[model samples]
Target: MRLPRSRRRSETRDVASDKSEATSQTSLPGDQQAAGAARRFLRTALAQWSDSGLPEAARLGERLLDDSTLLVSELVTNAVVHAGTTVELVCRLDTRESPPGLVVEVSDHHPTRALRDDSGVLDESDVPDDSREGGRGLQLVAALSDAWGISYRRDRKTVWCRFDLPAGDGATPLLSLRGEPPAELIAPVPPQADRANDQEWAGRGALSFLAEASDLLAGQLDEDNVASLAAQLLVPRIADWCAVWVYPAGAGARLPSVWHVEERRIDGLRSVLEKSPPAADKRPGARHIAWPATPGDTVGGGALAVPLLVTGRCQGTLLLGRAGPLGLPDEVTGLVEDFARRVALAMGAARQYARQAMISTVLQRGLLPPAVGRIPGIDHAVVYEPLAGDWVGGDFYDLFPAGDGRWCFALGDVCGNGPEAASLAGVARPVLRLLAREGYGVCDVLDRLNKALADEAAAALTGGTAAWEGGQARFLSLLYGEITPYAPERGAHCTLASAGHPLPLVLGSDGRVREAASPQILLGISETAQYTSESFDLSSGDSLLCVTDGVTERRRGQRQFDDDDGLATVFGDCTGLGAAGIAERIRHAVHAYDSAPPADDLAVLVLQAR
Candidate 1:
């Protein structure tokens, strides 16, 4: 029954007493018959190896023979099914180990195709629960092979496996979680005769695998991404398939990611796994049991499910499934646990960031007014924008009636951005409204707000358990104004003060622009500072323009939007534009000043006489 390397080996070597290592290779056409030819080839190899004690092949030849032929059948079937090209299979007795190892390589011409998904259905989408797939062949290979991996050359792709033909049966490869495993695990070493060289190959493959897994998992900042990465990282590389489950107490469990080695069966696998969520295991070693948490597996259930533990908490569970009752080797199970720890850490970090962002969003919503109030007899417009990616920023604006004959408006910018500056702005806006409605003038409101901010800051700095010690802003630039209109068609009486804010500009109907308020010290600087209000007549067809530093300080290399009186020049050009027209024109001009977006928060307001 022996087939030659070229069908030309002498029949003398096939005798029962032959001790030389039996090795042969063959090329089969890319067709369904390839698997049968491969199985027949394995039968002949085992028959010739009957005399040699390569490992325990002589004593346990019958068991090894059955497993090896099945392994060959599965590997060659996959090549014919997916690659659909000529298959080059090599079967050899590699004598580099304690006894010796049987190395089988099944290669095909197609190399770059994606590893087939067995279920074909992926993710959490609905799929038939009992749907079948063409992955059992791989399941058989997974159950039987000691160590296996895929390799690629320019001309073909090869699936290779090594069988440590069981020595003495005293404690075998299908070891307990604490038992020792073989040394050379999937290392890329050439066949040789030195036993010490086999030991050198041990650990390198595992270290490289974990290092690459870390590189991919470390940069992920989202919980779902952590789950997805962890599942995919285990598949094909370590496990035949994997699923990641993240659940919290009092919350519904989520199956975020699933992957399988065969390119087709992803959906069927996901459906089966979904029906039986693994119990939350907080143990040190992987719980070797059926893992869809199901009663039994059609593909011979042997899975390791363990909690993803970090900081004494279980963020999720990771399940790695193999083909047979033989779970992962002892070393690999430890590796899986270590991998779970990193995934747990990443998930925890992502969740923390999400909570902060949500809180910031709610706080930001409370700090700003719902809508700008309408002003009587004054054509007014307001522009407000925050820096991108910031939930809350330093800049704030408001336009509201003070419940009398006068309407008040304010715009301010704190020293810095984020929750701290947002808190300051949040406090200042409500206080200004309260003071103005109580009959305080524009300058009076500024004075009171300045005292409140400085006092609060001082208290926080001097006390333990202070809320704003690390996050408080040191300064705020503000512009406060009050408008009283006599007639709908006439100019209004305006009183305003600038607290280290941009100077308000009045653009005349005659094309002349002039400053309406003078500069003063910023609030939160001095509690004893007295402020003054400037009064000016806003005549018909004249526009008043106000903005924060985000507008005036917008930069283009060495030049700013307001450099060399640039803002004034831009305002002067808007001769007779209405409130909204002037506000939009100036906004456009500021943005056009540079090709890049503004680096700070922007706010603009404009008012024109009827």
Candidate 2:
């Protein structure tokens, strides 16, 4: 990971252009903390380079920034652990040419420990042991950079790498780095002896095909798209026909996609694959199989079957067929197997991601409240918008009949996200409902919820049960209330309590808005948490709006959707709207405020008195 001082400086000088070159250097002690310092230094360098009026840094985009940061950490850590000497780091950006590029060099005073292949280039195999904990730094450099190598002097050694900036015109650029010529300038002519060069040339072409296929696969996460891409990539390149058969959970294999060079053969190939038996081994990996050629078949080659195995389970199979009389060579077959392995890994990851998403969706739905039944003298509407991510958020709302002449409703937000937050919400909602049904007031219900959550947290901390062992200590901000009709006065009596939750807004009949209650401490923090109810009257045409922080805290770049005053103004403008109309208006306004998806979950409940 470390490079020699003299060679590092020489390589930097070779790539550095006086017209538009910027360089930064730092030295770190060879210790565990060097990697962190190196990453920080890289961040500062990138920031300064970006601000120095260099278009190259901007063109490099966020991906390069991430990759370069990772590379620096890996290289610096390798030097700290292996070289055991102070490490010198240098970063340079050159943009005088039509296309720009970057060079990073790490030098350490350890000459005898240089890692290189027989040809003097750094290679993966040069790492002495595969089973060791931390020897993949060079491999990552090779994979991430356009070019990487090592140079040794009598007293020091240097490891250096370079990357070409993506073209400003958006075209893919060649990977040539410093001291390397463009591919067109060094293009090789085909040998006159076609047969002698055929095998070598085909090998190179196959490798290129695999590389392109890997890039395509990496960009997609859908199972059907991946399977179809695999099929299409094989057809007209390595085979005349290709078919992908995927095995669904607890079901037999099914052909998801099939491709052929000739349109007429597509149906026949699909039928053949559909009727084909599982591989003889019935296990994971790749194999060659005899084609079940029909009597009228025009094609002549055999078929190769490669299983898509994930974690030792066969998830699917990839079948490739050739039209030539001769079978593929041993090397070609091995390459096909390698291609199958990559597809398998991608498919497995996609499947796992899909499963987790489904689970999160189901949990979210289960924790959410059901639709409110008809309530006398009241019109109500609620909107819930979850953030756009894999995990379920902790916002929730519910409305149900508390008892005779009263209805209970609650809106709350747990502190975190994902399953843990969802679990806490799940526990809070039903317990609050049960206590309210048993005739507890708003304040009493919240007190009980706090105790339940505190007990759960204590159980989790003590590992008292399997259900609580992996649980997280969670807190919630809640607004709970009950409403009863005043038949004699044509209004409703409302009792509301706030526990560190956003204050509920009341939109008056005359176009004024105000908060319903003052704030209290959040739940699950203290056993002696005291909550008090605030009583208010909802006259004809008056509406009470309750929401979580997701509404008030929604961000679009530097600006939020609305603060408390802004929300009050918005509410006041909806003076004559019904409950559902006003709820829809606010939801639409929040959506329009930020076209980008909200980073947190949002919930709003509105109740208008008749």
Candidate 3:
């Protein structure tokens, strides 16, 4: 939506110096002399505003009057030559809180006849050329004033112009829909070419101040600093007061807080505080939210409040104020919002940097546990790689002893990724290790894990209750195992229990490879789930290779499969390789399986029975 028009005069010919002191005079007695006097008064007022210390007021004055003074001259000229009647001009400074500005009116005692403004020939087409000279009086008046029209009383009709000048430094005039000047009054003595030069010079002086304002905002994202610069710029452009405020901190949907304040006096803020704060929903963020001044408040000013938000979070607000109640234009409001966004991004970056550092510290401490304690006839090695980028892969390995002179270990993939998924792994990993040591069998270990995951999953679902749908809810995919070993020279045996985990690959002395497909049920689904154990015979020089899906599922181009047979064939065909050799072969095969690095996190564990 568009900003509303200002209601006071900015460029009046005889605007009073002390707005506090009211003036009642309008026109001088005679026609020719009065037109000349009006022109002179306008030139003087324009000069004073340009030279005055109150740049904000001067800016408002310049905006209100520049084109308007010319229109007044054209109107007066028309009354003298065409109306054949003396016109009475009355200028009043309407400083009311609602329609605060200057009003200029011209009245004549000719009620029987309407004022006909026909200073131009209507062509086949209605467009007017710049070269046209005779008919342009009423056109000029409508072009300048925020609103201009004629009203008739019983005996006379008054032609009046109302200019909205709230802060004394109002923005550029928004042209009317017709795109034509309203009215014109011709002077008996015309302005020479050199006189036009003087007006140009005056216009340049006014523009220079606005240029200063642009320069001040060019290199900074600080809203407070920009407001101060805007106030200073307004002063040199016109004689007026300036004020600014910031969006308050901790404002909610019910009410918003003010951030920064820049004003000529404390009374300006007091005036605003007396009125209700703007509705938060109407002007969500970084868009101007304006409020009218209180009825009896000591201040009369215009305000523009813009919120600063980035990534859906509010940073702050920028509020600018003037001495009267006028709102900012959309263009100006957009510029302020852009500045606010830049500031918000800088702040967000700083916060993200600190958070990343903290995450890194905790992850480092959670790296794989040191090599498991020695078992006389066995040698082992383990490797883990965390998935890169934002995703946190939940691959974990554990090794602990079962009381029956057997050692147990498990490698599993907990479904999902990132901090929350990592958090679930963080809880499940250590708990499983403790449970194994506490004599819980494979099924019992999974039963306890499911209980823990149930609570964790519920919290996740509840936290996103607004966004949750049945299809989008989270679940985990996990695998667990326990192994018991015996003396290999005596053709000893090992018993294996699995919880939906990948089968261990066995390489025999006869140059043959096979997988021990143990019966299994995935962990963390239900408490009553059961898993059976599988037993296998072993001898010296035999190797057991257990790994996560990240290894066998490695992809080259689009093809991906669990290459269990290929890996077993390689180990059995090579022959005579120990635990370390088997581990090295698996790692090499993975690197070669993909022309590029594997997409998921990879884990590998190898054991040899001597």
Worst 10 residues of 1 by lDDT: 175-184
lDDT of 1 by residue, 309-386 (tens): 776777789988766553455677777787787788888887877888888789878877868655667898877878
Give the distance in Å from residue 458's predicted Cα in candidate 1 to where it truly belongs.
4.9
lDDT of 3 at 253: 28
Model 2 residue runs over 4 Å out of place are 1-12, 18-208, 279-285, 294-299, 461-472, 557-559
How do the residues 1-610 of candidate 3 rate in per-residue lDDT, one tens digit apiece? 1113443211222222325222344554535555545544544444444445433334444335545455555555555544546777665555643445556666666644342435422232322222454225554555556766555666665666766655545543221211211111111111222233334434423222222233334433444554444434333122133343333336432222222223344464445553544433224444333445534436655555555455565544445544444444444444445544444454344445446756755763473555688865777767676665544566777676767766777777756556655665666677877887898876677777766655555665579762222333234445465655566344345655556666777778777788865646655555455556566766777777778778767787666636536666666665787677777777787778767867777788876677
Tens-digit per-residue lDDT, 161-261, candidate 2:
77667766322122221111122112122222322433543444444345445656765678887898887766654566788888878777677888887
The numbered model that scores best in TM-score is 2
All candidates' TM-scores?
Answer: 0.62, 0.71, 0.42
Error of 2 at 211 (Å): 4.1
Candidate-wise lDDT, in order: 0.71, 0.73, 0.53
User: How well does candidate 2 score on lDDT at residue 499?
Assistant: 94
Cα lDDT, model 1, residue 108? 89
| Global Cα lDDT for candidate 3 | 0.53
Whose lDDT is higher: candidate 1's or candidate 2's? 2
Give the Cα error of residue 178 in candidate 2, in Å: 25
CA deviation > 4 Å runs, candidate 1: 1-202, 205-212, 248-250, 291-298, 457-468, 471-473, 489-491, 573-585, 588-592, 595-597
